[model samples]
Target: MGKVKISAVSYTNTLPFIYGLQHSPVMDAISLSLDVPSTCAHKLIQGEADLGIVPVAALPIIPHAEIVSDYCLGATGAVNSVFIYSEKPIEAIKSLRLDGQSRTSNTLARILLRHYWKNETVSLVSGGAEAYVEIGDRTFGKQHAHPYVYDLSWHWQAFTGLPFAFAVWVANKPLESSFIQAFNDALAFGLDQRDALIAELPPRIDFDYRQYLMENIDYGYNEEKKQAVALFLSLMESLEDPKAAESLAKRDLPK
Candidate 1:
């Protein structure tokens, strides 16, 4: 058989996983592609790749998807990367623009606004919204530009007292047991070398890269994360929009 194709997110948060995949023994067994979160999801859904590290929100739209790894991009309090920036406070904001590069953060922002912030008139826009959801490295050091900045992860924790899972390793279909083992080993190798990876990163004046990676981001797929995912999906189902609930239910596979 040919080498397994893998799609990974091209973000600083995924640096460790990328490093592990590139430097490990399994590198020869798989083909790797780096892309933005939306592209990663598209590749997996379209069968252009066998596996992808995709946003949790994309799971609902992907059929027969299975989370294949034991690690994820998650946050306990503040992720710092996913934010809602606005000139006006969230409650007073009339419209919200969804991030073009994100699906999970956008959904999280909408859920938080409706459920926790009690905003009723907030409408989602592709552009030209008074407030916008921004995710990934670009959001770093840019919080000062907005008078009202809402960190989605921090607010999720405050509202639900749970950690949030952003991206997860998912496979469209099952693969050999040996390959799965190798994949896990590669990810573990990357997690173990996080300190070295952090040191090699270019310094940033606006945000503390070390603290953001080491302290702010949680990189495990533990039971707590599972609960968070379940909670998030359930919340999505509760939305009044039938289309939104049906879309989220597609990934509500039995654990």
Candidate 2:
């Protein structure tokens, strides 16, 4: 077979995986494309890519989707990158503008507002809202502009007291077990070299990039993360249309 086309997130959190993929022996056998979280999921859904490191929320909606890696983009307490920035206080905000770059963060914002914040009056608007969901590097240094800056993962941790998995590596269909093993090894190699990777990055005044990557973000796919994923998906299903959720439930995905 030809080189497997892989779509991955373009955020700094993914730098280790990118480094591993590019520097490892598997580089010769795969092609990589960098994109926002939503686009990564879209490419796999449309068959434009063979695999993707996509938002966890996108998994239930994509047919035949299967997680293919032992690593993920996650947070233990506070993920500084995902936020709900509001000019007004959280209680006063009546509507929110969803981020154009990410679906998971947007959904997370809604779920947090409805359940944790206890604000069902808030509605989603296309634009011109007092509050907005922002994710990735765009959220850096921008917290000062809003009076109420809510960190989505932090709120999730407060509500559930569990680490949250934001994104995972997935494939549309099964691949050779050997190829999967090689892919996981490459990611592991990159993860092991995080210090070297951080040293090479340019300085940012907004936040401590090194500290954020090392302390806030968690990179493994273990049983705890699996439980978090399951709970998150169930919450997402509760927020979905009844018919749609039932149809997806019939597909035999973990509940």
In candidate 1, which residue pairs clash?
none
- Model 1 TM-score on a 0 to 1 scale: 0.92
Local accuracy by lDDT, each model = 0.88, 0.87
- Which lDDT tens digits does candidate 1 get at residues 1-255? 689999999989999999999889999999999999999999888999998999998888776899988899999999999999998989899999898898888889888887788897988777798899999988989989978898999999998888999999999988898999999999999989989998898888888988887888899999989999977877665565778656655754222
The estimated TM-scores of all candidates read 0.92, 0.93
Clashes of 2: 0
The true-versus-predicted C-alpha distance at residue 130 of model 2, in Å, is 1.2
Q: C-alpha displacement of 144 in model 1, angstroms?
A: 0.9
Off by over 4 Å in 1: 240-255
lDDT string, candidate 2, 36-85, tens digits: 99999999889899899999989977779999888999998888899998
